[model samples]
Structure formats: structure tokens, C-alpha cells
Target: MKTVADIILHNGNIQTQDGFHPMARAVAVSGKRILSVGSDRDILGLASSHTQVIDLDNRLVLPGFIDTHFHFYEWALNYDSIDFSRVGSFKEMENAVSNKALALGEGNWVLGQGFNESDWPENKIPDRYDLDRIAPNNPVCIWRCDLHLSVANSLGLKLAKIGFETPDPEDGVIAKDTSGRPTGVLKELASNLIRNVLPKPSRAAVLENMQKAVGDAHKFGLTSIHDIRLMGGLDGADALKAWQQLHRENRLHIRCHVALPGEMTDQAIDLGLCTGFGDDLLKIGYLKFFSDGGMGARTGWMTKKYLDAEFGMPLTPVADIERAVLKADQVGLSVMVHAVGDRANKEIIAMFQRIESHDRTRCIIPHRIEHVQMILPEDLEKLSTLKNIAVSCQPNNLSLDISMIDSCAGPRGKYAYALKNILKTGVPLMLSSDAPVADPNPLAGIYSAVTRKRMNKTPEKGWYVEQALSVEEAVKGYTITPAVASGTGDCLGSISKGKIADIIVLDQDIFKIDPDGIADTKVDITLFDGRIVHER
Candidate 1:
């Protein structure tokens, strides 16, 4: 008698994202592994009366998404915080803050995030005075969308102790008016002062919040992610503990590859940890390093000055990065460094070249660069020819940064987000949303990559249309490429025999839809570990 399969998904347009079995009409799952993938007739032969069979009704099925770069742990906790993303005008922002403050009442901290004042019609960053007028009794701290800058109300500033004469810390800026009074805008490491003053969430709270995020991720077809750190490299230990507890309790449904801040590289080394240290469900990923601030905050450390601003600044000196890379790589710790500007990218590339020359086999996983958002064409050869280096780009950011890049990068914008060129260079370019920074929707990423246009589809011809990727290539960014980057290529990322049974069925065939329609596509069913986790 043939063995009965646990579940059989048949009559579907399954795009396996595997080179061997690129397409299939049905797939059989036994336990947590794929039993077989083939035509409906061949797969049905393995199913018995006890098996749960599903007919996809011609829907599109593919491997579950893996976000190469995500701060979803932190984004999950921000549910209680105010969300000011896409606020059109200053009046709207104030109104939103006023409502939240009223809800929280007096003396309570009113926390918020995702305020991009640059996109507002007024084109002005709100000062402490603007927040004080509306929420005088409550302490308010709202972070910019980029997470590199924040604005605090007077009460919040007082709590953080910024009453002028406080020297700007190295690698940080405390924005102030001419009279030397802090305007309540804190940039880079300066935001840490206010963060230190704010009440911290307990570990239990973090785990609870992460459970909610897991449930939410299922609905969006995300089965795995690389949990990255927040700015300034704080709380890596605490965050790891939270994830460890969640995994031990068997409450963690998503596969997590957690990256530790480079500051903790020594601790990781002492603990005998290296890349891919844990089991399939949880693993130690990379030693994450931030080389520069974000472009959204005009602190991306560009090669040339912005249209009106100073040459952007480097958040971490090259010496610190080089030392960490050398030490970590010697102990088999792969590095995932964030580089968003041409200068940062160029500098990091040089550092990687030096390391590659010295020791090529130390790290188990070769170094990767996160958000290769900008690179001069002249320097493309470094990233492309280097077989060991990988690149992770977030097209979702392109949707939010089209205007910002144009304004800030000016004519040099040609070199910004040159994803297609990166792909041609033989570099493994994985797609990620960056979550809280941009919506962590893989479909939205595909839309942006295929269109090179913002949400509104401005610039009728598309922004640098030449760089747009085909549907197949864009889809690969979220699937096969990321799977290879995370070192799960053999077991995940496709519907193939012996691979993990992680799949999602979409309401629309993304390849058949118009470029604009990609963002509107929805998931109808999601299966993780051979079980139906989401259905709509």
C-alpha cells in the first residue's frame, strides 16, 4: 500500500522557484517535509482517504517569503506606539499626536514612530514647541520614519536632560536653534539619551508582542526572517533572550535567523557561537554592523554633498568596522554590514577587499552588505566580481525613497538603487522590506522592483526605468536568492521533494497581472511546516 500523505495541494499554478522543478501542478506533504512535487496525477497517487486535499482553483502558489533584512521584533512592539507614517501635513501630524496624548492622559509617556516630516506639504520638521502646544501635560517622543532621528516634546526633553550646553556626542547631532536651545530633534546616537530615559518594556512584554507579530506575519506569507537590530546596536542580548524564551515555549511559529550587533561579537565568540549555530527553527545569523545612517535623515555618508546639506556623515568609523570584521571573521562569524550611501558602500567595499586578501576561509558564511542602496558605477566591479560577498536590497524602500533620493542625491541619483546592474554582476541580490522602515510586504517589493515607481506611480515613464526587474527576477529576490543567502537553499525556498513544506497561495497570478496590480495581490492560503496556518 502507498503511504498516505498528510496533505495534498493540487490543481494549482505552483511556481516552485527551484531550477530543477521550476513549476508544478501539485505537491504532497508528509510530516514537515515535502513528499513529492509533480503533476496532479502523480501527487494524488500518494494521497489516501485520510489525507486533507486542497484544490487551489488555479491560484498562484510559491515558496513562503524570507525577509533577508527585518526589524520585525521591534516593529511588532510598536503596535501600542503612535504610527505617523504618510501623514500629509503638519496639521495632520499634530492632530494625530493630540488624539493619542488625550487617550493616554497626563504624566504618561506618549511614544510614537514613523513620522517623515520630509514628505509633508509644509516640508518642515516639527519642533518641540509644536508638540508642547498640543500635549503639554504628557511627555511625547516621536521618531522619524528612518529611526535615525526623533522629536521630543518639552517635557520629554526635560526628562532626557537636554537644556543646551550639552555637547553633541561623537557621531551624533542634537539639532538646535541659533540661540543654542535644543529644538528637541535628536539625530543618530543623540536619540539614545531620550531612549535611555523612556521606560523599557519587559522581556515578557517583548515575547508577548512577538507572538502577535508571528500571527500577523502568517497573514502576509512570511515564514522566515533575519531579525536585525534597532539603531545604535542596543538590546541584542535582551532581544535574543526573548526569542530564546519564545522558541523554548514552542510559541515561535516563524523561523528566525537573529543577527547580533558587532558590539557583542566578543560575547558571541566567547559563547562558542558562529553563523548557523542553532537548529532549523532558530539560528545565529551574522555580526551586524552599521556603517552609516539612513538617507531619509540625510546622514547616509555620501561621496558628494546633498543638494543643500553637508557631506553626509559616517555613523561608524572605518577603523572600527575593519577591526570587527577581521576579529569576527577569524572566529567564523559572518558580517552583515549596513551601507546606504556611495561613500559608505565604497569604504566598506575597500575594507572587505582587505579582509578577503588576508583570510578567505575564516567565516562560515561570507560577508554580506545590507541595503546597497547607492554605489557609484565605477565601484560596481568590487561588489560584482567578489564571489564571496552578497547583497541585500529593499525595493520597498525605493517606493518610499523615490522623491527623497531625487531631492537628496540630485544628479547622482542615477547611481541610487541600481538593482538590475547589481544582479548582472553575479552578486546574489536578496530582496527584503526592512519592515518598520517600509511595509514588509513581499508583493509591494515586487511592484516597486518591477515599476521603479512610488505608490502613486509618479514619473509616468518610471524612475530609472532601465533598472526595473522582470517579474521572474523580482520574485527571485524574495524567494530563491534569500533562501541561498540564509543558507537554507537545500531545505527551503521551493516546493521540491525533501524540502520543507512552506508554501503560500496567492489570489492572483502575479506574473499575469499588470505591474501596478502586483501591490494589490493578496494571499489566500499559507502553509507552514505542512499545516494550514492562514486561510482567507
Candidate 2:
């Protein structure tokens, strides 16, 4: 008995992602899954004469890209906020802020993101006085490109309830002016003071934005995404409920793997919610823990304090993070810790080792350390032994962190975003955009991974020339590796029999082109469940 195929995509250079079939000419689909992948004759044999045949006419096709770490709400939030990401000068930034404030009516907080002081002509972070002169009564909060640092206006500080008497929290910074008054520059955990006061988006807004994000993702050749932080807590249970509501109403499109935050991890576990608790539409990813702050904010925990800084590395003491990982593991939740600096990576490796010894790899939890930036050579070697422990690294960091890297790490800045070093360690590497932090463009990320060039197109041989990965290796990070890390490898990553038919067609042969040209390649078509989601 033969299974009847519903759709057949013929006459294309199919990059299987699977080692066995590396390249093929066609693929046949039945309903929502791949029925067969081979020559046109082989596929046509499985397809009925009435089946729809999509003529590729000699194009390049590959598995849909998967992002292992991204923030859905943060990306969607930009749809309604002032975007200052392109400001090249303080005057430009000032004008944009002032104009936006004047038009925003009264009493509303004028929020914006993606400002990098290093790129500004004056080399100065805009202060409260600059904002006060523009907006006056309206409060303002402008986030640094990393999304880890922010500068607030005096009114914004007051709204966040900060005062001269306020003490900096353990993991955050309150940058004050020379006169001892709050200048409104906040770092790491301190920025949350204002974030906590901000209004939560209504459920209607979440559904709308998530849909928009999914549509945008498909246009970029993305089929699966792992959302790192869900703003409304409890595994972002409220957000998931809304998504469920949308899915039930037949409105949802993309596949989401939610990374439950530490704030809601205990409660979720207590409620017996474990990893992969949902179906193909939505599922639990990992138990996310912040072992350290971000690189751009200069807050990533380090073995040694950042050079010349008064405060040493800010970290979630090893004991605290370890306890959390251990507990989550006991209840079948995989741990995904953000470890950027050497000390942070070392501590997280220790936590994984402890869990590996105790749990003996039960249920194959894809425990991973996010960022894994600036890791010690020893820790990388240590990570190689744990089969289930993976690394989700943002290759685009090279393009975005050049200035922050130079400012914070000096010459070693070259070693900061080492994707190749991570891959060489034998641990599976996953790729992501951390979108809103970086655009969710895998081609941009892959280009950065291979060339290591910053936005200005500087650095001919890349930051650390020896650490640049080949284009083939970079594709695996965006495809099968992330699928494996997210626990959907068996069903979603490859274009093979029994795998869900999620595919993307490219207009150019990225593999055959020069490393720089990879960024210029465009997505021609995107499919989910064998149905066209986006076509260009």
C-alpha cells in the first residue's frame, strides 16, 4: 500500500541539512509532513496525478531557520515605540526625542530603545538634563542597544520611585551625577525599577503582536522560535493562555518554545508543569536563569572585576543559581542559564556537571548555557563531555558589540563572541537573534558568524580570524542544532521522512557565494506544514 502525497516541490537544489542527503532535487509532501525526498521521478511516484506540484525551476531550498533565543514582546513593542536605533549623533537623538515628545501629547512616558553611546559623535550618553529640556513634563526612558542599560529623565526617575536616598540594588546600578543627584542612567537590574512601573500590554495586544511577529518571521524564513523571556510571569502562562485562545480560534501560525523565567519557575514546577508540556503548537523550552548581566551593559559576571570599576562582577551567587537549576531538573525542567563572562560560564558548567551526576541524563533535557560569551578554554573543554548540555550563542554579537567589546574587554574583545571556539569544543551550538536586541535575521547572523565584521564592514579578517566558522557549520547552528536543543529535533529540524514539512526557499546560493554576499541573500518562499506561509 502506498501513501498518497498531496503536494510535490520539484526541480530545486534541496539542501537536506541531514548528512545523508546533503543535496537533493525534489521533495514530496503528504498533508502536513514530508512523505519522500529524492529525484523528481521518485517524488512523482508517491504523488497522485491530482496532487499540486510546485515548480521550483532550479532554486535553493533548505530547512526553515530556527531561533533558539528571542524576545517576542520586546520585538513587538517596537511596533508602537520611538525607534532611535539609527541616530548617529546626540543632536539627532535629541531632535528625535524632542519631536516624539511634542507629538505624544501630555503625561505619557516617551519610551525608546537601541542607543549606543560609543557610536554617537560626542561619545556621551544623553543625560537627564538633555531629556528635561525636550520633554519637560513627559517622562522618558531610552534603552541602550543591548536592552540591558537605560537612561531616564528626572520625571521618569520620580515615576519609578527613585530618589537620592535610594541605595543601588545588589545586581543593578544607579548612575548619579557629580552633584550626587540621580542623573537617571540605570544599569542591569536598576533599569527594572522603571520597567516595573510601565503598563503591561493588554491580552488583546499580545495576541495581535504575536501574530504580527509570526508573520514577520515567516517572511524572514523563520518557522520556529524560542522566546527567552515572557513578560507576564508563570512560564508566561498568561501569554501562553492567550496564544492557546488564538490557536483555538485558528489564528496562530508559528511554533513557539517558551523559556520559563526563574521568577515563575518554582510556581510552574509546583503546579506540575514540565518541559514539552504542550503539543506542536506550543511547548515549554527551558528554565531560564540569569547568572550574570549582559555584555553591552558591562555587567556580565567575571572571575576578576571589570578593570578599574568600583563594583566587581555582578552575579547571582553560584549557590543561588545552582539551587534553582537542581530543583528545576528534579521536576523535569531543562535549565538554560545566561552565562557571559568567564566566571559565569565556569559556575554554570559546574551546575550542569552536578545535575549530570545526579540525574544521569533523565528525559534528555537540553540543558544549555546562553551566550557562553568570553568563556574559559577549560570550561569549553569541560562542556564537551555533557552530551545533552548545549550552547545557544548569538553570532550577531560580533556585529552589534564591537564598540562595547572594545570598551570593556580591550584586545581580548576579539575573543568575546567566539562562535567557532564554542563549536570546536564538541558541544552542539544553537543560533538566535535575541531580537529587538538584534534583528531576527539568520542570514545577518550567519554572515557575522562567517566574516565576524561589524556594521561598518570593518575588520577584514574578522575579530578573531581563527574563530570564524564555515558557512555550512553556521547553517547547522540555525537549523538542526537549535531544533535538537529545543527538543523538537525528532520532528522539526530536518527535511526528511517523518519530519514536519517546514521549509524555506532562497533566491541565491548562499553556500557558493562569498562570505559577505551571504547577507545579501533573500528569502523567496516560506512554508509551514507544507502550506505556503510567505512567498516573495
Candidate 3:
């Protein structure tokens, strides 16, 4: 009996991202997986008259992108929020919020995200007073691009119970004015004061947004993501429930490895759930915990003081985090801790060293550090030496942090986003968008990794030029590296026989194009689980 392919893509340049078969001209898909991949002639032989054949026209074809770290659920639910991702000035941010408030009418909460005052001409973060001046009637709260800082209007502050007399939460700060009144600018945990009070999006709203988000992601050629539960993670159990329900209904097209919070280790263990449990469409991932805050908020746990500021702070100190790691490891759940500063990474590495000392590869899955962004030159090798530890770095964050790294980190910024050195050690370097914090598009991330430059390609020579990675290396970070991290290496990540049929065809061959053009790259067509989901 001859096996027939359900669909076939031929006449194109295909980068397999697989070491075994580095390139191919055609690929055939049957059901939910790749049936064959070879030259056009070879693949065409496997296709029957019923096969849906797509001609690539000498374009670029690659495995769909996989974002290793993402706040996908939250990003989706907040889809209608005013996006400040590219707003250039504080005044512009205010105008955007005012417009949203007017559009939504008065009395309703006007939620928005992605405002970076650091990139503005004035270089000053917006304050509550500014938001009040623009949207006095509607309560407004907008997040900084980093998501670690937020500014709220007077009405928003009142709703969240934040006032002049309110003290900052532990491991967080409330910016105050000269007269010692609360400025309505909250950092880290302080921002949660507002988030906790805001009305949660209904279950229907979340599911709808999830579908819309995946549809939009397909346009960017994204096939998979690790949906990180943070900023009120697990949403008191609603988040995971929604994901599982979607999977059950066969409504989810994007592969997801939904991560839980570290504190939920007890609940996970109680349910006898281990990391990597569940079907391919949805799986349980590592337990996520914040070892420190973002550098943009000046709360990253750095050893030395930031320029003109005090030393950074860690949200969960070493001792506390170690306890959580040990508990999770004992229950067979892998850990993923966010560590951006040198001190934070060092502390996490030390904890893992101790955990592995008790048993080699203690957890079923390898432990990982998210955003191992800023590190000392001497400490660079420590992360790679841990065989079971992976580093998930967001190169796109580098584009946003290039100027901030230099201005705030001073001379210590030399080793920021050390991609070249990290790859040299042969440790798994997973690339991601950390979406809503940055563009979820993996091409933007790949461009930043390959060029080490901002969106406009400023600085001509690129920032930290020595830390740049090649185009292939960057693709692996977004593809195979994340696939392997999710325990899908055997089935996903590459356009090879037996792999899941998640593929994307590009309008242009990114390999032959200029480094800057990588960001402008667009997906011409996308196929997921052998089904055509997008074509542009």
C-alpha cells in the first residue's frame, strides 16, 4: 500500500533546522505530522491526486517559530488595551490613553500597556497626575513596556486603595513626590495593587482572545509558545482551565506548554501532575518563579549599585527561592526562574548546583533561567557548566534595553545579553518575545539577535557587537531550542519526516537578505497540524 500525503509544499528553499537534514526543497504532511521531506521530485512522488500542493515559488520555508517564554494568556486577554509599544513620548502616551478612554466612554476602566518613558525624548516616566490630567473621569492604568512599572490615574489609585498614606508592598516601591505624596507610579509588586482590584476578564473573553491571539501569531509564523503564568499567575486556576478546555474542544491550533507558578508546586504534586504532562496541544511546563525584577525598574538583583542609584533588589531572595526549588524538584517538577541581573543569575546557578549535587538531573526535565540577560564576564561560564540548566534569553529585549543598559548599567553593561558567549558553551539558548513586554514576533527577536541593533538599525555598528549571533543560530533559539525545551524535539521544530507538520513559508529568503530586513520579513503561508491556517 502506498502512503499518500494530505498536503505537499514544493519548489522552495527549506531550512530544516535539523542537524541531520539541513536543507530540503519539499515537504509532505499527512494528518498531524510530516510524511516526507526531500527534493521536490522525491516529495512529489509521495503525493496522491487528493494532496493539496502548495508551490513556494523559490521563497523561504522554515519550521514555524516557537517562543520559549511568553505571557500569552494575559497578552491575549488584554488585547483591547491601548498598545503603547511604539509610542515615542510621554505626551504621546497620554494622548493614546485619552483616546482609548474616549473611545470606551467614561466610567469604564481604561487599561493599556507598553509605554517606555526611557525611550522618550524627555526620558521621564509618566506619573499618575499626568494620567489624571488626560482621563480624569475614567480610571486609567498603563504599564511600561517592561511590565515591571505602571502609572495610574487618581481614580485608578483610589480604586486600588493606593493613597498618600499607603506604604509600598514588600519588594516593590511607590514613587513619591517632593511633598511625600504617592505619585501613582508603582514598581514591581506595587503594581499588583491595581491589578488585584481590576475586574478580571470573563472566561468567554479570555477564550475568544486566545483564539484571536493565535490567529494573529500565525501571521508572524509562530507555531508554539510557553505560556508563562506571571503577574497574577494561574489567574486563581482560571488560566489553566481555559487552556485545557480549549484543547479538549480541539479549538487550539497553536501548541502550548503552559507553565504554572512555583508556589503551585503543592497543588500540582497533589494532583500527581508532572512537567510535560498532557497532550501535544497542551502540556504542563516548569514551575515559574521570579528570582528578581526587571532591570528597567532598577529592581534586578545586581551586585553593584546602578548608575546614580542604590544596589538592585531581588523579589524572592536566595534562601526563599532555594526552598521552593527544592520542594518542586522533590515533587518531580522542573523550575524556571527569571533572573536578569548578575547577582540574580549567580544566586540561581548556585541553587541549581546544590540541587544537582544531591542527584544528577534531579528533576525529570532540565531547570532553566529566564532572561539570563545581564551577567558579569567572569560569571558567564557558570550557567553553561550546569548540564541540566538552560538559559532563555529574549534578544528583542536587548533592542529595548540597548540605551538603558549603557545609561543605567554603566561599565558593567559589557556583558549584557551575552548571546555569542552563551552559544559557545553549547548550553541551550532558547529565544522568546516575552510578549506584551515586547513584540511577540520571533523575526524581530531574530533580527535583534543577529544585528544587536534597535528597530531602526541605529548605532550602525550594533550594540555589544561581539555578542551578536548568526542568522542560523538565532533561528535555532526560536525554533529547535524551544522545541527541545518543551520535550517536543522528536516531533516538532524542524521540517523533517515524522515531525509535527507546523510549517511557515516566507515571502523572501531571509538568509540572502540584509540583516535589517529580517524584521521586515513576513509569512506568506502557514500550515499547522497539516491544516492550512493562514495565507497572505
Ranked candidates, highest TM-score first: 1, 3, 2
Clashing residue pairs in candidate 2, if any? none
Q: Candidate 1: where are CA atoms >4 Å away?
A: none
Per-model TM-score, in order, reads 0.98, 0.94, 0.97
Candidate 2 C-alpha RMSD relative to the actual structure: 2.2
* Pairs of colliding residues, candidate 3: none
Candidate closer to the true structure by lDDT (higher is better), 1 or 2:
1
* Native-to-model Cα distance after best TM-score fit, residue 255 in candidate 1, in Å: 0.6
Which of 2 and 3 is the better model by TM-score? 3
lDDT of 1 by residue, 142-222 (tens): 988778888998999899898888889877899999999999988888988888898888877888889988878888898
Better model by TM-score: candidate 1 vs candidate 2: 1
What's the number of clashes in each of the models? 0, 0, 0
Which structure is stronger by lDDT: 2 or 3?
3
Candidate 3 deviation (Cα RMSD): 1.4
